[model samples]
Target: MNTPARSRITAVLPAHNEVGALPATIASLRAQTIPPDRIIVVSDRSTDHTVEIAEAFGVEAMETVDNAARKAGALNQALEILEPEGFVLIMDADTQIVPRFIERALQEFQDPDVGGVGAVFRADPPTGYLELCQYLEWARYAEQIERTGKTFVMSGTAALIRWQALKDVESRFGSIYDEQTITEDMRLTMTLRACGWQVRSPVECQSTTETMPNVPTLWRQRRRWYLGALQNITEMGWNRVTRRYIGQQVMLALSVILMTTLIGLTVASYAVNGFLGVQPFWLVIGAVFAAERVVTVWDQPWPRRLFAALVIPELIYALILQSAYVGAVWQKLNSSQGEWAHLGTPHKTTEEV
Candidate 1:
């Protein structure tokens, strides 16, 4: 009996001014249990030592510039140099993957019909209260993917792309990641599905990436994400699944409006009548939520369970985060769609993971 030959896998990281975060990313790639056949670091006009770090790791280091499409352009530049065959694992320069991440993601390729695989990311030992909130949210999302076997986009944070599926996208759109769309990951996933490729994110296929460090940074990051999602939704034009996703966003928007209106009216009533009303309802909602999360945080330590039971932190986080979607709607309506800066990276960053 002979063992099966594993597919050739190439990992590409599009980096811009990622000198501080690139080392661990490189190390993790090197440490993959079923390591990539080659690792390419596309240095996108970075002022820092991104290229040097890649060279130091002895992987292929290529510099690129004049990429109006930014990350996708950098990636295409690499594609032009190398023959597009085998599986391509796209990763962020700041992300670190678990030792078996590549091996697990590649296993999904056992079914040739599976075009892409997205990783389940937990904030890498998150720092700060804001990051903890994000970590919790990520866990819930990962749980959803685990349960449903589906996701909106193959996360650009860490994703494996079947070369043939990518070619299908490129032949139609002339690029793997559409440069016109702001949220390239979502756009690529939609494109893949439209081309009859099955896409999924296995909850067990894990990676670790830094979460947004502060409220302002998170707001900026998600604002771009939401705005890009809106743009892609519009451009997709009647994609049934995309429409359903949009409808969900619309409901979320309405909920926010209704909540704000109720809060405002309550304040006015309190001032006029010298009585507090609706306060108990708010307290109950928080209490119910805290209890739900605490119960859901299975196998987690007591300290984390207690943190999960504190609804205030997550509540504040949601209020601000959800508002980013509204701001994105405004940007979409006004045609003021901004560039994809990518997880608070300083300059141009756009690509399909």
Candidate 2:
């Protein structure tokens, strides 16, 4: 008779002063349909009650004294304690998994070839204008990854990894989450791909994270992300999978370049034809941007979804992100080392992360 396989799963939540969101995140894990065999929360130099809260829920909590790589360091410390033969999940403390996230994510691991599974991250409940914009942008990003049929980056917000793939990654980088890079998720994706491990994000494995409350914080965050992306690409070298993703980013960069060209053309038009040349270009751009939004936001409600088609907000939002991309390219060109700055999260009196 064949023996039934036991679910040897360990989940690690690396938190640094994340008291506001930790309670709910822990509660969701306890309520998982396929509950993790063990749940560990690593307190990464936390000054608040992150460890206490984890202990309160009967979850094992370990504190990291002074490891440098931030989240990556905390996670590596936790992984060392967890058994290697089991599957492991790394989740951001601010994120809350959908009710059936474990059920949905585990379904993908049955494939054996799938080494890592990521969740489709959504904003918890966007309250402000910028928050809503971020919501729409994330929804579109989730849609794009799903359509591509190959998810390159398994978000740091939520990802489940098979033990073997973690081993493969550790063998290459000395740590599952590399301390050498700010964007550990992207590096892990490249490493796993090179090792012939499949990574994916199923729509059903939905999760949510807090959005940056303001534009400045959002800019800083994205600037780091894009800069790290460029660093990873340059460091990893263009391979088959990385090439496809890089191609899209390169096109996005070109769009930024194209906008500059458009501005110059508009000036030339003013000098030659009283701005007549740029009007045609403006009309074409308006139609295309509107149409793009309409298609992308179809799943959203009516008027709010209609906002996706609006010229001003949509263009302004795109410009902000494009500016971040431009900033990233400039920083990368200068060999500037980037930092992880996920700021503007809700803070309690004790000041949570």
Candidate 3:
């Protein structure tokens, strides 16, 4: 009896002016337990030394030709150039995976129906309050993914995808990625599932990603993310694969509305009565909610867990995210194009992992 042949893995990192983060990212890829057979850095008009650094690491590096679609365009270019027999890893330039991430993520591919495996991402050491909030938020998301065994998007941060699945999408849709949508990862997720493929985000696959350092950058990052998700859902339309996605969006909108209404009523009541009104039943519910937050982030550092227990700061963070959702809705209604906010590279003074 002949043994089954193992599939070769190719990793494609899409970068734009990522000189500061490229070296560490490349090093992480080299250290993977099941390292990629080939590493390709797709440069999107990077003026910095991103290409030079990639070459220094002895990996294949290529530049995109007249590509204006950002990461998706660069990925499409890479997809067109290569014919891989197995899997392709689409990873952001800013993300660094654990040594065993590829090995573990690849395990999910044992079942032929699996189309993609996404990373459970953690923020790189946060330097500020906002970054810390993002870190906790990522932790909560990882916990949810672990519990549910469902994936909304094989995060653009890093995802291991089957080459055959990409081919299936192209055969049906004419292109592997819809460049028209800003969130190609979400669009691809919807497309793959629609075509009878399953996407998973297992707990064993983990990575660390950079966080926005300031308010403006965070706002832009989230606004673009929210807007991209909404746009992708609209473009995919209603189908068995997309119905859940649309439902998730509906739930999120309802959550925003509920939060706003609760806050408005609280404020109105306080204004009407000179002394603050307190409801014992609502306080009990709020305590349970805070306890749930703390439980979700219990694996994180004590500071973060304490922060979640406090609840107010996270409440503010929730409001910030909800505001970004509203902003995305406005952009969608106005048909405004979302702008990519290429985050600034970390300071040279910071030690690379």
Candidate 4:
């Protein structure tokens, strides 16, 4: 068992109509090995039973009348009312933590220089095939976090950020409450780095959260994410270049663009070959890529992992979605608009607390 230290820890959950999942998420928090000094839930214009549910859990709840700014605004509002001397754990109401997650994260912040830390996030299980594919994608992400202490972005689902770090640039980095763009995580990460802080993911801190379960939901999520990335790249281009932080962003952007082009070309080539009554070399290339994905997913079970390994289909879908998102991003950039379209509702699930 981990002993609670003298250091005060505040857990903040920015919620919006999260009544269905908040109960389990709060239960997991109550079961934490190191109980938080304060548990605050920021209710963002929730028309549901969110406020009542949070009261039932006995957590301090504050409602925001003007939720025009979305999550960042909700979080900042909570921050304004909380004691800022200790660490702040920013979590989503849809996620549940392992017993040791907060304890482990607190220990990591003891390093002093660490500004923020993220956890190993697993998408909720017993989902459909598409959801399983998302889980595999998250698994790969977790591996990357373990391999490199530096993560390009931190998931809001389970992130422990220093209060001082947040306060330093919270006001300078634009309106925190405005719901513009889907890439708030990336912007926050960049802001921290700009303030001379490092963010990391400790392997022991684990959290499970739901993922989009179907192609349509997945497409919308990815599109918003891509759009956010593009907006961030444009807004902070100079900061990124001067700080030498654009390398990874550029590489990822290029990779997505290249993948999209390759897939489109391959499809066009196959169609032309069919018309000309000849075999296409593009088919051979596609087969080789598919084989690589299959080999990559080989460590897992037969059909599920194999289905997850289908690189071509996934890449093609990503390209189409990202292309449309990029267009939306460009529109926002040109018009100087900084708000995101709410993608209806997010899928929710729970794991053992």
Cα RMSD, each candidate: 3.5, 2.8, 3.0, 4.6
- lDDT (C-alpha) at residue 272 in model 1: 100
What are the models' TM-scores? 0.90, 0.92, 0.95, 0.83
Better of 1 and 3 by TM-score: 3
Runs of candidate 2 with Cα error greater than 4 angstroms are 1-6, 267-285, 342-353
Query: What digit string (tens of lDDT, one per residue) describes model 2 on residues 307-353?
Result: 88775786788788889889998999999988764454446322112
Q: Which ten residues in a row have the lowest lDDT in candidate 4?
A: 344-353
The alpha-carbon root-mean-square deviation between model 1 and the true structure, to one decimal in Å, is 3.5
User: What stretches of model 1 exceed 4 Å from their correct place?
Assistant: 1-5, 278-286, 340-353
Error of 4 at 265 (Å): 3.7
The deviation in Å at residue 227 for candidate 3 is 1.2
- Per-residue lDDT for 281 in model 4? 85
- Worst-scoring 10-residue span by lDDT in model 2: 344-353
Candidate 4 wrong stretches, greater than 4 Å: 1-6, 171-182, 240-245, 275-299, 309-313, 333-353
List lDDT for all candidates, in order: 0.78, 0.80, 0.84, 0.70
In order of lDDT, best first, we have 3, 2, 1, 4
Query: How high is the lDDT of residue 5 in model 3?
Result: 44
lDDT, residue 92, candidate 2: 81
Give lDDT for model 3: 0.84
Q: Compared with the true structure, what per-residue lDDT tens digits does model 1 show for residues 211-323? A: 77667768877888888877887877777557766886788788788768867998999999999855788788778878888766654667777888877677788888878
